[model samples]
Target: MNLFAALPEKERLIAERFDSLIQDIKPLNSKQLAFLPRDIQRLSALLTAERSSLKAGYMNNAVMLSAYTRYFMRWNLFRLTSLFAGMDTTAFDFLKDGDYCLDIGSGPLTVPIALYLARPELRGKKLNWYCMDTSQNALALGENFFLSCAARLQTEEGEPAWRIVRVKGEMGTRIKNKVSFVSCANMFNELYWDTHNPLEKEAKKYAALLLSYTVPQKAVFVVEPGIPRAARFVSLLRSALIRSGMSILAPCPHEGACPMEGKKGGKWCHFILDTESAPKNLQALSEKAGLPKDRAALSFVFASSSPAHQSSSKPAGGKTAGKSAQGASRQHIRICSDPIVLPHGKTGRYACAHWGLTLVTGHRIKDTLSGDLLYADLSAQDIQALPVDRKSGAKIVNV
Candidate 1:
């Protein structure tokens, strides 16, 4: 179900609140927004620049906040909230009502706001939320935005939805609470660039830190931009967590080493959220920003200290079995990259199956999309020896 389906009335109310919030911010006007395109272009350059060359001074500050509030907020809030909405709530089924949550780099409390909107069950529940950030201004602003959202979403006489703690400091400074849920969204890339630390070192450090704050059956979620570099970094982070004994919870059907690692620039794994039918305010913002309102993309990893209490096996027909998890009728593979349409009339799709990276090709594979959990029959030949042809070892199945 869609996020707003739980409380239909709140959809309009939330959209109205977004309009009011933006209007209330005096400097965030059409003229300011018009100028934001330039800032957005500059910010994009800064983000994709070489790590050592970055001006750490301008990374996170009042200036950046102004740009975000005026221009980036519309896209970021829309994208992130859509991502949160599309998440599998089963990943959070283990969390209890009163469990604590810690959101690192909680800029404007994006993840928390999305969580509440996506899971209305969280409303009227006493969940403690701790927001950690290095910028006091960001924390203050986030607090205001979060409270406004909560006030609008909460009904009269209902239990307070959350008990929030705003902590201003570098994230991962210490493990304050045994958090039941932890989210780090679009924060690691900045950490990597600002600190000049290798992705592996940073991933290892944060993996340990996140684990320290998490109890069994709890989860840690990380999301980055959908770019190839960011996707690869997330893959590295996921591998580190897996080696550290954490279990894959969402997205992936197997915990094997990511199939995209050894390959050099073949395909990257990421998810897409269709945002064409978003709320009125969001659509208006997209139109104003000269950006497409149809799709939002991101790469994310969700891992838990305990294995998901569900069947790992793929279902009957399109099931593609993997070597990692046994006792399944069908094998499963995660499509890591977009399909390549060969000039010879067959489509080529790169996938991560139980046997490792497999080049899936066939006449029936034309409709296969990236990020799909595909199933096929590969028992006839070894996955490693399969030829890159339409008649490749496996035939596409129902999945």
Candidate 2:
């Protein structure tokens, strides 16, 4: 189910509140509006090609900060919404009354705002939110935006049930209280950005740091841009976390090693969502800024410190132990890529199963998409009959 697709009303409400809050922050005149696009382009370059040139505390600049809030931050919120919508609700089951959530590198409280808008069940919970960031300015603005949005929906005397505590610090900043949920978005890439450190080493270092913020059985959510490097970083982090006894909850159905990792010039782990669902105003602003997006691409990991959930356990591999009258075993497979057209008019899609990378092919393959969980039954004879993909080395299964 597309969770975000079911929340049109909430999406509209968030976009409205965001527009009202941004307007109050900086009411742009005609000339300022014209210059906004240019500012957005400059900021994009700094965050991308010219990122190394970007110094610390760059958000301190009013113009750059404004551009970020209008363009990057808005789009990030949408991306989070799309990501959360795709995930299973069980992933967020750890969050409950009186729970504590620590959001790291929370510039303008984008994660918190996105949570409030996307996950309505979490809104009424008496949760403590510790939003940490290096830029005091962004934190302050984020607080106002969060409160404003919450106030509109909240009716009680105190308004929002979640308490917002802003902490101005960088990554690894300590929190005095124990947290049940830790969320970090668009922040990990900045750390060691210029370094040539091995990806595995970096993943291990950051995984330990992020896990330290949450207690056992709690969860940590990480989001990064869907670029190759970031996606590969997420894959490495998934492995490191699994080795540390953490169980991944979303985007992966099995706990086995990632097959997409270490494959040169091949597909990476990422998902894409169409941008047409975003607010019309935000979309228009993106076009004006010359950065219109047809799709929002992101790579994320949702993991728990506890053991793996039974539903996400490894699939039976060509075993007849659980076979039915059809002489095939049924197991859950996670679709990892869009449908691929093969010779002989066969449709194939990459998936993750207990046996490792698999090519699930059939006429019905086109009906499924990346990030989908499919249950298929295959016999041992069927599995032994096909050749592996030469480029990706995935096992082929025709259903």
Q: Pick the candidate with the highest TM-score.
A: 2
Local accuracy of candidate 2 as per-residue lDDT tens digits, 1-399 = 221333458555666467667878666777877899999999999999999789789887788788889889999988887666545555566678988899999989999888887777778889999999989888888888888788776757686998989898998888888799888999989985676888789999998998888777688788889878888888998898888888877667677877766346967877767787787888988899889998887887778876544333333232111124357766567777667878887788887777778888765676665566666565666556556988678887655
What is the per-residue lDDT of model 1 for residues 290-373, given as tens digits with 9 covering 90 to 100? Answer: 554566677888777777532322222342333322333445676655666756676767776666666666655666555556
Q: Which stretches of candidate 1 lie over 4 Å from their true place?
A: 1-17, 25-34, 49-63, 194-198, 278-294, 309-328, 361-368, 377-399
RMSD of each: 4.7, 3.6
How many clashing residue pairs are found in candidate 1? 7
Return the top candidate by lDDT. 2
Count the clashes in each prediction.
Answer: 7, 0
